[model samples]
Target chain A: MKKLNFGIISYAHPHALRYASTIAQSRRAKLCAISGDGANSDVAKGEAKKYGAKFYKNYEDLLKNKNVEAVYIAIETYRHKEVAIRAAEEGKHILLEKPIALTLEDADEVIKAAEKNDVKLMLPFNPRFTEPLIKAKGMIKAGEIGALEYIHAISENVKPPIFLQGLDMSWFLDINKSGGGGFMDTAPHGIDSLLWLTKSVPKKVFADIGAKIYGFPVDDIGTAVLEFKNGILAVLTAGWGNPKGYSYGLEIKYYLVGREGFLDVRTAYPDFTVYQDRAEKIYWDRPDVRGIVGSFVTAVLKDKDVPISGEDAKKNLAIILAAYESSRKGKVVHIDL
Target chain B: MKELKIGVVGCGNIFNLAHKPALKNIESIKVIACADIDGERAREGAKAFNAKAFQSLDEFLDLDFDVVEVLTPTYAHAEIAIKALKAGKHVIVEKPIALTTEEAEKMVQTAEKEELKLFVGHVRRFDKRWVQMKDVIRKRNILPMHIRKREVQNLPFPAHYWYWDENKSGGVALDLGVHVTDFLRWFFESEPLEVLGTGKAIKEEAKSNDTFDHFIMVVKFEGGKTGIAEVSWAYPYPSRYGVFYHHVDIIGKNGRIRYTPLDTPVVGVAKANFEMPRFSPLLSTFPDAFERELRHFFECIKKDIEPKVTAEDALIALEIAEKAKESARKGEVVRL
Candidate 1:
């Protein structure tokens, strides 16, 4: 079996390390090269040395390398369209981070490039990879609960990349660079999972978004109610408002209702907490990151459709943008997509 | 320590489950009479309290009770409380002072002109958790910037009940909405400037009523604070009661406070007694807030002081809820 040789573009987003580590340990994937271009270049260089992979000072140089068959692009959000398009044109299968681009036009261009170049464009929506939610999706598909009618999902975190990654994540709070704050960063997970689980398109969105914590220019709290074409009413609350002492720093939960039965799902389930005098310790009972990267690697190797495509992510981004518009205009914004 | 003679009107679910049990625990108050549109429940309630029973408020108001606790349906609150106040009785009314602000104002004015004490049952104000939250915010100067609260329950009544009728009961936006809106106004200590809302019925039983059993309302307060209230009566379907869940998160300038179902330790699995509030079924407990609320009402009547929850405060919450309903209906924000 030939291992898929992978190059990682920029270590700006924290998920870079997860993908790199997964490739390092996998039997079917190889960490062929690492690239850097911005303030995170040194970090990228250090990661390359630690992983014993070739290092490229610029991502284009990495793309120029003939042996790199695939790339996981973890650059900042504003640069997603540019880097993804470049990766696609390089004939490399790409795993793109979420919020595909800042606008629908940019997202469309990236999708067009991927389709034109015949490359698989997958968005790393981690929830789609988690075990419990995967099982929930299977149950919904099997009609375990009758026809799905309503869902209330919440995705919350302790601020952003800073608390989770211990890095300066001020870029995520900048409206111009990241597009929006907590909702923009976190709601994509819930929105994507909702769309996937219900297999429905959104018809309207009404939201109330604001800077509720830290008084940052970008909003820290957002709540949106969406009506789906299938008559599913989904309410999503995404925020960076968890206090310091919460056990699960990243908590995602869902309340699913159907005609016959209901489901209360905690995405961060099968975890344990240890309380000691010095500090509290929390551990995920099973590894959740494995499937996200492994499945993408296998999809590229098998020449099969990726689990979540660029078009699916574009719809997620469209809903997010509609929520912002709804918040701004203080009206329910009808989503055509 | 004198015994305060109290007359309770509208012998319904709340009176039987919350007020009767709580009033029995209070040694300083005695129920002198009970009245209801349903004479059977009124007689049953009188028997439970060892009081007289009457089929009409006109007949009941003539009794020699010092205060009247109006626990009738929300639409009847203003007329009943005003009538009680005019009869020279200090009044204690269940929340949402009236269906409309005009009616709430008339209740307030009548109480003022009659020179009698009027207290509204905004029970969360007396709950220790919320009071402590207020203390933390004020004492620590948390300076709340955004507050989120959600209260959800299975449908407490049958499909044919007034609760399913939007015009009769005002749906969840006015029913459960008032409970949380009152909390938001109290927590922020500022008037709400605008409200944006989205709501739906969601249940097939409510599909014909043209009412929302679930609603999410976003309120912007005067001091640049934000409050979100997501209230629902559409918890688990099939009209099973006794499922209750609530969450509160207060994000402020200096600190954050949150409470979720995970924090609660009590759990029960049963048929979920349909007669009680959703909490009473699973939690197997009624909040002691009811007793504290009754005690405070008695104190206000005795001390001749304003209540912890006043008619004006209730009126403000009702106004916010009404605006929220309008926002949900028009699909736009409604300004105060």
Candidate 2:
């Protein structure tokens, strides 16, 4: 298999390293070059060196590399727009992290730029590709659980020390930088899972949320009840409330109620759990990161649909954004998507 | 020790399983008399507990008793409770203090006027694990809790009990949702601000309307804390998993507590199809929740103290539940 070359945009985000590492591990995907933020260039350089990828001071310079066939937009939430648009415009296949952009308009720009450049865009919703959830998807489709009537998903984290490596408490707390609070940050995985399992978009969203934990400008805990097209209801809870050291060690768990059967996916404790002293490390077993990036490579190489599309990311983001709007307006906001 | 003679109205499953067993366990409380619309059921319950059997509510109310346990189908809760309260009898109506907010208020006012205790049977509060969970939540800065009450009655039940009635029993939301709704309020010690919900009625060959099999509700509490709950009676082929169960996850700023029946300590191997969790630790000894609740009820009556779940508390839960129905119907958020 001819390895498709991959490039990293920024290492400022937490999942940036995991995505870069996945590219490095893939048999069909090679980590080609990296672009680090101007302020945090050294961290990206170290990350590139550790992963055996060349570092580029300018993102555009990295995009100009013919070996960089695909770019993974692991930048901060706010810069998702500019970076994704530029990458898509460069005709490079894009695998962006969740929250494709800060706003729907920016998401639209990314979509348009990708279409104009005729590139496949994939969002690395890694958990969805986990072995258990893939089986769950097959169950729903195979009618093992019949029609999905309701789904309750939770993805909360206490921000393990590893997650806060180069970042501080205020880094993700700033609305200007992160766009939203705990729910927005932790909710994407659950939101995407609900969207994918049911294979339906939300019709309305009613979110009861607050910034109670950190008392920051953004909400730290919340639940968004999404009503999908066929009277299906899903409750998505994503927060930074569950402390790192807890009995229920994993921060992510999903439960689905269907007409024929029931399905539960504990993302944090997805596969297994282990205890070492006071810290209970939950190995929410997932496919190798390469499986996600490799899917992107396979999609680009075969001219097939990516595992996670920009449209799917847009819908999930819309559900979450509507949740925020509902929280602020104190009402159930209808989802046009 | 003075014994409080308790008269029971409406001979139902909860009366036989929950109250009778628990009240019988306590020494200070004696089951004196029982009444039901059906004379045979009343006779059956009264005989086992060494209590007298009355033919009707009026006859039962005419007798002397300190308290009355209204175990009728939920539709009759307010009516029976109001009559018992006006007669100067303490009321322990089963969960869902009343069918509507108005009835709940009337019951509350009547109890206040009569200077009698009105305890609503939100029995899950008595679960030692749940009590411990709430205590931990209070001591810790718990953020949000997700509760699920899934009854694997997925294959259409015969609708034998009044609970299957859409109009009177209030389906799964009011019947089951009320428990967690009250628990959430008790846990937060706050009033509800808003409620948004969505539910579905499973299609089956039945009378009137299909049983409301599924419901997902979210409630906003006063102190920025929130609760999300899903109550369902439908999840077909339940034996493929296990029996009915209640699960809860309490997420906090530092830690979390999860009670899942499926997360059993032991695992059981079955047919080649799959392996299922053997038995939930909580469900293994499920009667304790009701036993503790009944003990608390007896203690409150004897000590002349207010119960944890007051009529007002149940009223608030019902209020939120009612709004949830409205939210589901209106396809919009309903403020409490």
Question: How many residue pairs clash in all the candidates, one count each?
Answer: 0, 2
User: Can you write out model 2's per-residue Cα lDDT over B75-112, one digit (the tens) per residue?
Assistant: 89888998998887998888888778888898888888
- Considering every candidate listed, which one attains the maximal lDDT? 1
Which residue pairs in candidate 1 have backbone atoms (N, alpha carbon, C) closer than 3 angstroms, thus clashing?
none
DockQ of each: 0.35, 0.41
Model 1 CA lDDT for position A139: 76
TM-score of chain B of 1: 0.92
Task: Compute fnat per model.
Answer: 0.28, 0.42
Question: Candidate 1's C-alpha lDDT?
Answer: 0.82
